[model samples]
Target: MKNIISTIAFLFITINLISQENNQMKLGDKIGEFSALDDQGNVWKSTSAKSDFLVVYFYPAAMTGGCTKQACAYRDDKASFDELGVTVIGISGDEVKNLKYFKDSYQLNFPLLSDNEGTISKIFGVPANKGGEITREIDGENFLLVRSITTPRWTFILNKERKVIYKNAEVNAVEDSKNVKEIIKNYSK
Candidate 1:
């Protein structure tokens, strides 16, 4: 009985380690193709991005201060991003409905993906915690937004070859788009 229990524990640990190893991503790593539901409830796939670079940013939640600022910054800089041939995507653990609300509220131009299960966050090695609910007043109506997990602000830039060229774990919400533009400018040169 003791040997069986110990063997089972060993197997569990090994499996967990293997899973983490497979999901872990870092600078220079080529991210595998992935797809998720966007704010419009349409499927967004990595392979569908037609750009010289791709920006994948993970934020904690929707209807929050920092996330809103970050998203708005991106939306405001859509022209610049397009000129630079860069596609921007924001990922969060929020539900699809919540993502739609966020995008609609802010008039976000970029894709906001629903990573409600934290699978994409795990692949990017972004830390996530248990999710909760937040009530926000929108147009005189109180809406409850729930998320499956909360991921810290993190950003990654992938080159045309899909290799991670830049990774920012400590991102400045408001300056994220500006900083990314600078990085892309320099990287292009």
Candidate 2:
């Protein structure tokens, strides 16, 4: 009985490790190709994002504190990114309308894609919550509303060759663009 239990435990551990390995994207790995809807309702195909490099960031939600900080950081550094010939794309599971509001409110210079089904998050190995709904109060009345899946803070810098040159599973919200800039500068050389 003890031997059988040990075998079962080993199987469980091995399965868990395999699952995580399947989801992770390591350095030098090519990013999986994807096409999704941006905030403006236009299709963005990975093949068509003509640029020297692409900065793909996955954030938890729109209008939230850390997400906003990260978005604004990208926005504030737009000129520098443009100078480097890099294009930034932010992805979240929020509704398209909410993402639009977030962009307009923050004056974000880049496109924010709505990944409502968590497809992009899964492809990028970002942790995402399963879809659900929640009740919220608005002017003293409770209303049921859909909740966007939450994604862990993550960023991937893909070169023109579509290979991931740099990846950060744990991102610092305030210093995100600077970090990306430094990485780009070093990697470009």
Candidate 3:
């Protein structure tokens, strides 16, 4: 009985590890279709994007220092990205309400997806942890922002074929947009 129990435990562990490994995406991997709610409460579908390239960037949280910088950088580079035939999307565990506030605060022009359940992050193999909350003053009132999970900054670019062409696990928040733009430019050449 003891031996049988041990074998069962080993099998369970192995299966779990294998499943996790399968979810971790790599370059050249074809991304499966996904959809989530955008900050404006609209359903954004992967298959609906008509751009030549798709930029999917995951940030830890909304209204944070590093995340704000990364998002703003992307915002500032919107024109360049549009010119390159790229559609940039930022995903975070924040709720749609929080995402709306963040977008409005920064005047961000791109779509921000709310991945409150971490399902999207898991699909992209981005590391995620427990959710957190922070308070911020937007005028004269303090608003509490909550998240369901926190993901490390990661970026992936998919070509028109829906295959990942670039993956950056260790991303520099301030330089991420610039780096991705250059990468895409060079790739086009």
Candidate 4:
């Protein structure tokens, strides 16, 4: 029994290590293929959206202070982003319904994707939210459920070839769009 347990532990450890190593997303690396449900309840494949540049960002949650600020900043600069032919997509672990509400409420023009499973977040190496729970009452019965984890505040700028040209692990919410513009300007030269 002891040997069997030890072998199981070793296998688990090895698998965890391999997953961690595969989750590293760095500059110059093309994003892994992912399909996510967007705010409109449409399945969007990352490869389907091609442009001169693509900005894939992960935020903690929908309708939150920091996340709202970051999203609106991008919305307000739509013209500038459009001028540069950059497509911005924001990802969060929020459900598709919540994402739609947030987008409609904020008048967000870009795509907001649901990452409730944390698969996309893991692939990007962004830390997922640790704890949260929700209690739902349906018709008279009450049920407690753990909330989906959110992703870290990070952004990636990819070039035409879909290779990451710039990555910001710690993004400044309000100033992130401007910073990305600066990087794009420098990068285009």
Clashing pairs in 4: none
Clashing pairs in 2: none
Sort by lDDT, best first: what order? 3, 1, 2, 4
- Largest TM-score belongs to which candidate? 3
lDDT of 1 by residue, 72-150 (tens): 9999999999999999999999999999999999999999999988778877878678998999988899999999999
lDDT of 3 at 12: 100
Q: Where in model 4 is the C-alpha error above 4 Å? A: 1-22, 131-147
Q: Cα-based RMSD of the predictions, in order?
A: 3.0, 4.1, 2.8, 4.5
- Score candidate 3 by TM-score against the native: 0.90
In terms of lDDT, the poorest run of 10 residues in model 2 is 130-139
TM-score against native, each model: 0.89, 0.83, 0.90, 0.82
lDDT of 4: 0.84
lDDT over C-alpha atoms for residue 149 of model 1: 93
Residues 14-68 of candidate 2: C-alpha lDDT, one tens digit per residue? 9966776698888898886898888888888888778899999998777778888
lDDT of 4 at 35: 86
List the pairs of residues colliding in candidate 1: none
Write the number of the candidate with greater TM-score, choosing between 1 and 2.
Answer: 1
Residue 44 displacement in candidate 2 (angstroms): 1.3
User: By lDDT, is 2 or 4 better?
Assistant: 2
Q: Which candidate, 1 or 3, has the higher lDDT?
A: 3
Considering summed lDDT, which 10 consecutive residues are worst modelled in model 3? Answer: 15-24
